[model samples]
Target: GEFGKVEEVKESLDLAYMIKETQNLFKGIVEGSSRSMQIVKDLRTFSRIDEIDGVIQFMCNPCGKLSE
Candidate 1:
C-alpha cells in the first residue's frame, strides 16, 4: 500500500515537528523565566544594599535609634 506508507510517513513527520516545536517553546519559556528571575534578584539586591547596611549599623548600635 504505497498510499498508506506515504500517509504514515507524513503523520510521523508531523508528530515529530510538533514535538520539536513544543520542546523549543518550553525551552524558551524556561530561559526567559530564569532571566527574569535573575533580573529581579539583582534589582532587589541593589535596592537593599543601603537598607541592609543601615540595618546592620542599627543592630550594632545599642541606642536603638531605629524606633524613630
Candidate 2:
C-alpha cells in the first residue's frame, strides 16, 4: 500500500511540472510577440519621418539641417 501511494504521488508531481513548463512556454511566446509588435510600430513611426519634414532626422543626426 505504501509503494502504491508513492507511485501516485510521483505521477502527480510529474503532471504538475509539465503544466508549469507549458505555462512558462506560453509566457515566453507572449513576450516575444509583444516585442515584435513594438519593433513594427517603431519602424512605421520612423518611416513616417518623411511626412514630418525631417524633424526626426534632425533629432537623430545633429549635423543634419532642420527645415523651418
lDDT of 1: 0.84
lDDT of 2 by residue, 21-57 (tens): 9999999999999999999999998779755786667
- Among all candidates shown, the one with the greatest TM-score: 2
lDDT (C-alpha, whole model) for all candidates: 0.84, 0.86
| Local error of candidate 2 at residue 43 (angstroms) | 0.5
Give the TM-score of each candidate.
Answer: 0.55, 0.56
Worst 10-residue lDDT window, candidate 1: 59-68
**Residue 63's lDDT in candidate 2:** 82
Ten-residue stretch with the least lDDT total in model 2: 58-67
Q: Can you tell me which runs of candidate 2 are displaced by over 4 Å?
A: 1-13, 50-68
